[model samples]
Each structure stands twice: as C-alpha cells, then as structure tokens.
Target: MVNAPSGISGEASLEDRIARKARELGFVACGIASAAEDPVRAERLEQWLGEGHHGSMEWMETRLAHRRSPQGLWAAARSVIALGMSYAPAHDPFALEEVGDHARISVYAQGKDYHDVVKKRLKALARWLVAEQPGAQVKVFVDTAPVMEKPLGEAAGIGWQGKHTNLVSREHGSWLFLGAIYTTLDLAPAEPHRDSCGSCRACLDVCPTDAFPAPYRLDARRCISYLTIEHKGPVPEDLRAGLGNRIYGCDDCLAVCPWNKFASRAAAMQDFLPRPELVAPRLAELLALDDAGFRALFSGSPIKRIGRDRFVRNCLYAAGNSGDAALVGPCEALADDPDPVVADAARWALERLTSAP
Candidate 1:
C-alpha cells in the first residue's frame, strides 16, 4: 500500500516514485523542480542573446519569453521533472585527436540520435505519471523546444551547467542527454545540485577555438558544434583550422572534465555505442559521399539532421586540416558541388591541401 501527499493522490513520494520510474526507463539521473520564475537565468539568456551570441539560431531569440519560465510556456505546469541519460564513452573521447586523416565525430553522435532515444523514454515516463495522477496535465520536452533544460536540470538536482556551459554530473560526467517532463500535479522538488566545478579550468583551456567568452558562458558563433550543425553558410576562414578533424560537433570541452573519471567506471548504455564506421571514419570516404550516400550513411543518426551539404561542408574543413595529399583529389571533386556552401568549402580545402609544405 502507498501513501499520497496531502492533496495529491499517490502511494509513494511523487519525487521518489517518478525518479525510480525514470531510472527504470533508462534515465541515469532524475529530479524535480518547481515550475516557477528563474530571474537570474532569464537575465543571463537576455544578455547572451542581446550580444548576438546565438548566431543564426534565431529561434532562441524568438522563444526568449517561453524559455524563461516553464509555467509561462505551459500555463498549467506546476512542477518540472528533469532527466539525464548517460552517453558516457567506454574510453577517452580525446584519444583520436592525433588521427589526422580520420574525421572525429562528437562522441554523442557516434550512435543513434539521442533526441529520439531520450524523447521516447520521456514520453513513456510522462504517460506513466499522467496515468498515476488523475486529472493532471503533462507535457514532455527534449532539446526540441524553448525549455531552458540546463538551468532547470541544475535546479532539479540533475547536475550543474559547468564552465563549458554544458551540464556536468558528478556521477554521469559531461556526456549526458537531458529531457524534461512538465506537470500540473504539484510534484515535490529536489534539492538543487551544487556547483562542484570548483577551480578546474580544463574544459575552458582545451577549446581549440577559445569559444568561451567567460566561465559558464558560451558564444555559439565561435563554437565548432554550432558552426558545423547550425550555421548554414561557409565557416569563417580563421576558425577552419581550429576545427581539427571534428566533422560534426566538437567535444573538446566535455571530454576534459575531471568528473568523467566517474563516468568511465559507470555502466555504458548500448544505445550510445559507436557504429564501427562512425568511430573514426576516413576523411576521404566522408568527402566522397553524395546526398544519397550521406543520407543512407547517417540514417537514424543525429548527423543526418545537418543534411548532406553541411555534413560534407564539415568534411571539407577536416580535409583541409588533414594535410593528407591523398584527400586532395576528393576535395577537388566537391569544388563544383551543387550546394554553394559545399563548393566553397571544397575550394577552401583544396587551397589548404595544395599549399601544404
């Protein structure tokens, strides 16, 4: 037999019950936070956007108000359940840094799209909660909406958003996939996660592009993850070399956190297992992909979201940085690609390779 809260009906503590259910659903971390105003987060968001740090992701600016408060986004949402799934790698994500001729994809993109994986589980958890709490309203969200997941995650005790501006879990490390469940059931909130980053500057100093304008803040325009996946046009010439062989997203910051020591010893999820081909793909092979080839190769993967043009555009930059004379042939082949951005990247890559000593 279970006991209910003073007004809500449930046998177990709402927070405990939901957290256990979330773990059963494969989430490594779960906590709840009130769906109320977060003035400091709102102000930080406004300042970040006001400085034009979001780059071409104009949606962030448009959805500013919605992101400030969960209740504002959904008028009836009284509590928020923040969740995190570990995509922790079995080995060091930085180990491939010396592999000049191979494209190093972000560790998170090495497997199935996390958005699909996380959202499916979030929906399952939300459905269970709704069924358990009669007359309660609920909404689920992953990275797709205006939800300020990181701050909410912090408030909910999932983890603190570290110097890299990505959530860091003492137990799960920096490689986490976050999701949220908003409800009107008045669930109990958890103790907020403490800021454990301390004096560690490893994540900040490791950035090849120096993307951080300050501790705990990011300028997305200078972020390689943003440039490869979100920016539509040519990459800035100055930053191209800094990208190294990172063809999709950069994980330099996330990979360097000291908390990752705990993650390597933790259970690794099969859903995040790297596809053999994606582990360290040859730059030459990536550059050879046509649209059809690109789609088929990255199907059911997050890399597909960037589409062929952007994916290949990233490949071109890696090719230029590769310094492998053999890739010049493939680079030249894409110089006349149908997409202007791809063509520009190809020309730039060819120039770099041709001018190599």
Candidate 2:
C-alpha cells in the first residue's frame, strides 16, 4: 500500500497520483523504491568495474562511493522515485546497415540530448512532490550522476536489467530513458520487476563486435558504442570493421530484442522524435564537416558533446566501411586533420576503402 502525502487524500492513492502526474509530464513509467542500500547491486557494480568492463570511463571508479546506492550519494534520502520516458523509434534501427553510403546514428542520439529533456521532467516531478508534502527535500539525477539508475529502476519496478545490461520494460522494451528522484520522504518500495529475458539470445547474437562475453555481461572495450563515443585516439584495428556504417552510437542489441515488439512510437515523448537530417545522414556530408560546421550542425545534439574531432573520427570509420569511393575525396582532406585521432582515422579509412576487394 502506498503512503499518501501528508494532508492530501481524497480518492486516488499516492502512487497513482504520482504515476498520473509523471504520465502527464511525458514519462511513460514511474515507480517508488526505498533508498536503502542493496548489497547485491553494489557487489555487481564492484565486480563489473573490477573486470575493467567500463573502458576509459574512469569516473565510474572515481565516484564509487556515491554510486553504491541512492543513500550513499545523499545521506537523508529516504525514498527513490524512478521514471522512464519512451524513445521508441518508428523505424528499425538496423535498416541502414546495408545502406553503407549513409551514416547510422543511434536512435537515441538522433534527437535533442535526452539529458536535458529527462532532467527537466525530473525536476518538474520533484517540484510537484515537494509541494504535495512541504519540507520534503529532494534531489534529481539523470545519466549525469554516479547513481545506480538501472538497479534503482529495477528495485522500483520500472524495469529489469536485461542481458545487455540495459533496463528493459515489457511495455517500453529497450526504448526508455531513465531518471531518478531521491527524496527525504519515505515511500513503500514497489515490487521489483522480475527478469523476463529468459531463453532469448537475440540481444547477444546481434552484437557485431561480440562485446558480450556471456549472457548479462558486457565488455565495454569491445563495444562499438564505447569505442566510438567514450574511447579516445584510434579505435583498435580488429574492431573497426565491426563498426560498419555506425558513426555515433550502436543500436544492434537494443533493436533485436523481441520485447520492442510491444514498444510504441506513439508513446515516445515529442522531445525524442528524430530530426530529419539525423535519420539518414550521408557519410560524405558528415566526413566533410569542419569544427565550426560540426558545432553548427549538431548545436543542441548529444553528438556535440563528443566534439568535432571524435565525431569526425567516427565518420571516417563509417566511411572506411561504406565501400563508397565518392567519400574518398572527403576522407583525403581529413588525412592531415589538426586532431591526431581524426588524421589517424582518416588514414585507416583510406587504407580499408582503397584496399577493399
């Protein structure tokens, strides 16, 4: 049973009211979990980090204390509110795989940076919650925080962590953007979402680089998304071919999950709708972008955070895999790029493109 907010009770229960408000604010799912520490979640994170699966994201290890639990980050936190906003795509993310001349940005990154969108919604929810129960202190966190959002998401019954190490909703599938609100107000924890990925190897099988060492395990070093976005300098030689035409993030694992069959495009918040230019961007155009051009093109995009150099380097990798000789002229221009990484990627792409049988 949900604890109704103080001096506020009529018909709808507290959980129902919050759920309705979250839905009204564009979140598709909302659930509450106790802010108490979970040894299992903490241990798993320690194990994952110990295994070096985080790649070059050194911040994960640096902020290990706060990441262990909601309370670890904020001492007075008594309840955790988890929310999910749908970003489910209307089209298949893998459709561009055979269309090499075009770049394949991940479905999630094609829209405005989700960090801004989700955080705004989270703050709104927190504001409403505070107003409902005066003096109930709150702090909100999206992906930027060291919080264990997925585990909190699971604990709050938002979704279960799937084999791909991403939270999967039966309703939204792998297409939800998650955020959390830690409040000093105590609320009953929702029943945890049970694992439902049973007997399905689709997410693992679809990985182009075999990034998953086993079910429910990911080696980020071998992950195309990590290599393209997080890793600096040149990509490992063996993994470049696996990148294919994917210039930004990869969606292979998320796209193949059968649970997404239930995902609805209509459920997605308007903020997540793909921009026309990002949908089927050509490699030739992206490969030709200079710093100013890159900044202007991706002004409000998540891609902008990776900066012009990293993004161009990714485009070069895609160009190398494109088999489109027309991109050669653009790649040649970047061969002496100011950034060493971009220049290296250009040379690598040139070799692969010219030497291709």
Best by TM-score: 2
lDDT of 2 by residue, 79-130 (tens): 9999999999998898899998999999999999999999999999999988
- Candidates' lDDT values, in order? 0.88, 0.91
Tens digits of lDDT, candidate 1, 157-193: 8899999999999888898899999999887777788
Query: Which pairs in model 2 have colliding backbones?
Result: none
Q: Give the Cα error of residue 119 in candidate 1, in Å.
A: 1.0
- Model 2 scores a TM of 0.97
Quote the lDDT for 50 in model 1.
95
Worst 10 residues of 1 by lDDT: 1-10
Collision pairs in model 1: 2-11, 3-11
